[model samples]
Target: MEQKIFDCAIIGGGLAGLTLAIQLADSGCTVILFEKESYPFHKVCGEYISMESYSFLERIGIPLSSMHIPMITEVLVSSVNGNSLTRKLDMGGFGIRRYTLDAAMAKLAVQKGVTLLEQTKVTDIKREGDLFQIKTAQGNFSSKLACGAFGKSSVLERPLGRLTAKSAGEKNYVGVKYHVKTDLPDNRIELHNFNDGYCGISKVDGDVYCLCYLTGSENLSRSGNSIKTMERNILMQNPFLQRYFTHSHFLYDEPLTISQVTFKRKSQVANGILILGDAAGSIAPLCGNGMSLAMHASFIAAPLILDFLKGRLTHQELCMIYEKQWKEHFSKRIKTGERIQHLFGKNILTNAAIGTLKLFPKLADALISMTHGKPF
Candidate 1:
């Protein structure tokens, strides 16, 4: 078979990959995207996105105003013992499931003339001269540029030497998600802390609530690897969590889970492949703005990529600009999230922090601002 070379080859059809593909294709770049999973699938995410990317998504054809998803404007945080604080979000967000959001983006990418290869896994990528050779289950393909938007973990990372020795020990957390019928307020999102992790609850589309939590893997092993047991013994200790878990009707037959979640630092550009989203770096879920950050990264990367493809910028120049802009926008936020994570999951510290935030609303606002960014 004759090899077809694309202008850009994107791996992982998540928010970052799909959005970037659409932007480049709109600019008349020949784009091809590969996703191991089919469209309209669920992912272990909090399902809430910060409002900073609202305009960007609309520009890319996602009609947020028409979606009727809940607009979350207030935050309610609680400690392990159920002590709570409520704060108004200056720049609020909305909730939509990954199944809905990603599927919509995929459909739009197809409509915009992108060669989207769904259910195709990219096994390897190698750079030869100025082009990238991508090997996949389907066949060999080539592109002027390759992007790694694969979320969190992938086999490709090992071959690319993107992982350090510390990475092997870094994957210590487990994330679990479920959609449930609940009576949570539509205009508010809540974070409830537990022994070794935290849970976020918000109203997504279809009048259902997204209930997702991240916990230390040790917590699961201590409970014999049973999610229910961990929830009962550790999560239930929080009064708010106990009430929700006891009352809400879980929509899933079994909760969706992903293990080995880590917040370790990652390189944005590796082996001549431009990395985006979780593949680049993931913030602690406590921040509640990771989805926005992922989309924002694509927003920042697309222009530089277009310049590189147009010969207006060299690959080195493109990488330098993208790395600088990405760090300028996200590095501090990720670090702040890591610091904030330290304040949760413990009985005394969480309660104290909640109490302090409640007493000093300005401090809470400052902390929230630190983890979020201005509109792009």
Candidate 2:
């Protein structure tokens, strides 16, 4: 029998990959998706999504209006000493858990006729002539094109030679997330800074709040890898965080943690495979634009991909266009996020920056606007 070759094979089923798969499948292209974990799994993310992608999600079949998730329009940021600033967000956001969002996307992809492969891990990928060969635990698959949507850190990064010196040299950061029942306002998101880290609290679906934070790995080591100890000793130093931690009823028995979260630069195209989401590049979570950026990349890549598959554009043209568009849309936002991150996580500087922003509210709004993009 002749081997089956899909139009596109996506390595990860997160937001970017799943969104692209659904779009392609809806366009009547053959698409296959591989995900190591099953649906309804939790990930270490802030769970806040920019309103910019609201229409995009609805167009793709996620019924946002029916979900009744919290709509956040205000941002509250605080220094370690509890000095704070509040501003009305011009393009505010909504919060929804990864478990709910990803599972919905996965189901929609399948409904759109995408070949969904759960519990399948892609072991290797290589380009052979015009086709890309993918080896997975299930079996080998072939595709006219491949996309890498596996987020943040992956075992494939080393094999693909994506670990650049800048990424390797940076101080590693760890992220932790928990779902809790708290008194946080549904219309607001709060960011509290402590020593070497910051925490964000926002309401997601099911009337629960997602509390997530990122800290340098050294802080975790110093606390003997005890998340509780790190929170008690370091995070509680901030009065805002102290109040929440002490009062909230945590939903999870243990927090979900991910390590080696790098904000380093990455190439959009690596080894002839298109990379998406955090695989391409990650903005600092402090900006709260990562999810929107990921979905936007899919929105950008899907049309170019269709053009290539239909022969309107050559492979080289497709790659060139995607790379240029990705950079044009995201470079400034990523750079601005990096600069804003520097102002946080330090006692003196964070306090000073908050004080300055509080005095000049318009300046705070401008800085926040720089990290977000116009709705797509």
Candidate 3:
């Protein structure tokens, strides 16, 4: 049997991989994508994409009208103490469940002539002279360039090893998201404080609400398997959350949970393989724009990978370009997210800060700006 050859081989069929596959294919590159799971699958994510991704989505020919996701133009921040502030989001973003977004992007990839291998797991990749030989569970494939769009904790990150021996406080952080049927205003995104965790609620798709939360795993375990109980006891201690948890009803029977989410600054590429999306380095989820960041990184990398394939840039040059461009454009935002995470993770400090913000509403706008970034 003949081995399949492609200009590029993409690993992990998530947003980053599928988006880049479409970019490369539209650029006239023969790309093959290997995904471990079928599309329309659930993931632990915030599912919000900034206005920054709107142009990229359009560039790839995904019509905004075809997307059933909701648009949000406001951000609401509240404290455990009933102190709250709201900001009209300077730039609007869209919300779609990962299950639907991933499927839509994959369909776009197929339409653009990119080969998508569903349920395919890539086992290994080795650089063979000028090209890469990729080994998947199915068969051997060759490509001029390879991309790791695989999300956090995948086999791809193993070889680069740990960024530091210190855990950097990530071990305590866990994330969970739920898709629920509810009637909620589509214009706002709300962050509610629960004991050690924070929950974000917003509309995604036509009628489904995506409620995502991040917290300490130990706190969750101590609650005896009741998320609502944990929220009421630990999270709602904040007067603001107490009001919502007491007044509003959850639309889901039970929520989804993701344990032990860790974040580290990452090198954009290792062993000549380009890294894309969360596989590269994930900003703190509290930063609230990861989906857009992942898509933007893909937009940046597609051209660099293409240049290497075209022999316009050497392998060393390609890595240098990707790392340099990514850090220059994104390092500050990721760092800002880390700082905010530190502030919001503590109870007493968070309350005091929220109180201060309520006193001077401008502070809340500044914080919202920190999360939204420059107008794209």
Candidate 4:
């Protein structure tokens, strides 16, 4: 029997990989996707996407009618000292959870004729002339071009060889989130400040509210077998948070956490593999724009790769183009996110900043724009 050769191989079936695969399939290109996990997996994310993603979703023939995600029109910033500011956000953003979004994209990819290999992990990858030989747990495959859409750190980064310095920030950071049934305002996304971190609350599909927060890992280490203990001890420092936690009933069994998410920069491409999504670069968790940026990058990368496959662009040219495009579109935004990460990590600074912003409405709007603008 003869093996099939794909024009492009996509390793990772997250939103970025699925988006690129759907676009290429519609453009009549052969793409093979390898996913390590099954569908509808939960990821530690803010779960908000800016309006920039709508155009790309439309192009892929996905009507978001089923996604009852709310539109957040305003941002309210509050300090622990009782000072607050509210701004009318310039661009509207969606608050859909990743579980719904990822499954929908996967279904659309299959409908668009993409060959998906779910739960098939890629073990090793090496170059064979101009092609990439990908060894997966299932078997082997070849493709002229390969994409690294794998989220965060993966086995793929090892062969690429230390692209970025490891983040040495306090490894005590942890993110816990839950889908809750609450009588919360659907149109507004709230960010409440706690002791060492903040919590973001928004309405998503089925009118269930998604609430997530990042806190110190040591806080949880002392808790005895309950997320509630961590929240009460570490997060209850703020009276506002204490009230919310005590008042709002949960919609799930308990909250989930992702420990020590590092945010040092990573390479866009290495050894003929193009990195996409969190694989290429990760914004700080508090930034809340990583998923939207990934979607926007996928929109741009698919067309660039299509041009390369049609012999209109060389591989070097494609790599250069992808890197240039991403940096041009996202460089400043990422820098801004990093800055915010540093500023908000300290309780005194965060409270002072929020208090200062509360006195100036226009300045508060400017700050909101810096964090959540719809550039890409």
- Tell me each candidate's TM-score: 0.98, 0.98, 0.92, 0.93
Rate residue 155 of model 4 by lDDT: 79
Candidate 4 backbone overlaps, count: 1
lDDT (10s digit) by residue, model 3, range 52-129: 788778778778767766889987766656466677877768888888778988998999999999998887788889
Which ten contiguous residues of candidate 4 have the minimum total lDDT? Answer: 162-171
Off by over 4 Å in 2: 165-169
Error of 1 at 61 (Å): 0.8
Decoy 3 TM-score against native: 0.92
Arranged by TM-score, best first: 2, 1, 4, 3
Predicted structure 1, TM vs. truth: 0.98
Task: Answer with 1 or 3, whichever has the higher TM-score.
Answer: 1
Q: What is the lDDT of candidate 4?
A: 0.78
Tens digits of per-residue lDDT for model 2, 1-376 = 7889999999899999999999999999999999999998999999999999999999999999999899999999999999988889999999999999999999999999999999998988999999999998789999999999999878778767887776345778999999999997799999999999999999999999999999999889999999999999999999999999999999989999998887888999988889999899989998998999999999999999999999999999999999999999999899998988887899999999999888898999999899888888
Residue pair clashes in candidate 3: 80-238, 80-239, 82-240, 194-235, 195-234, 195-235
> Candidate 1 lDDT, tens digit per residue, 155-266?
8998788877764545489999999998888999999999989999999998999999999999999999999999999999999999999999999899999998878889
CA displacement after TM-score superposition, residue 369 of candidate 4 (Å) = 1.2
Q: Superposing all C-alpha atoms, what RMSD in Å does each candidate have to the true structure?
A: 1.2, 1.0, 2.2, 2.0
Clash pairs, model 2 backbone? none
**Candidate 4 vs. true structure, TM-score:** 0.93
Measured on C-alpha atoms, candidate 1 has an lDDT of 0.92
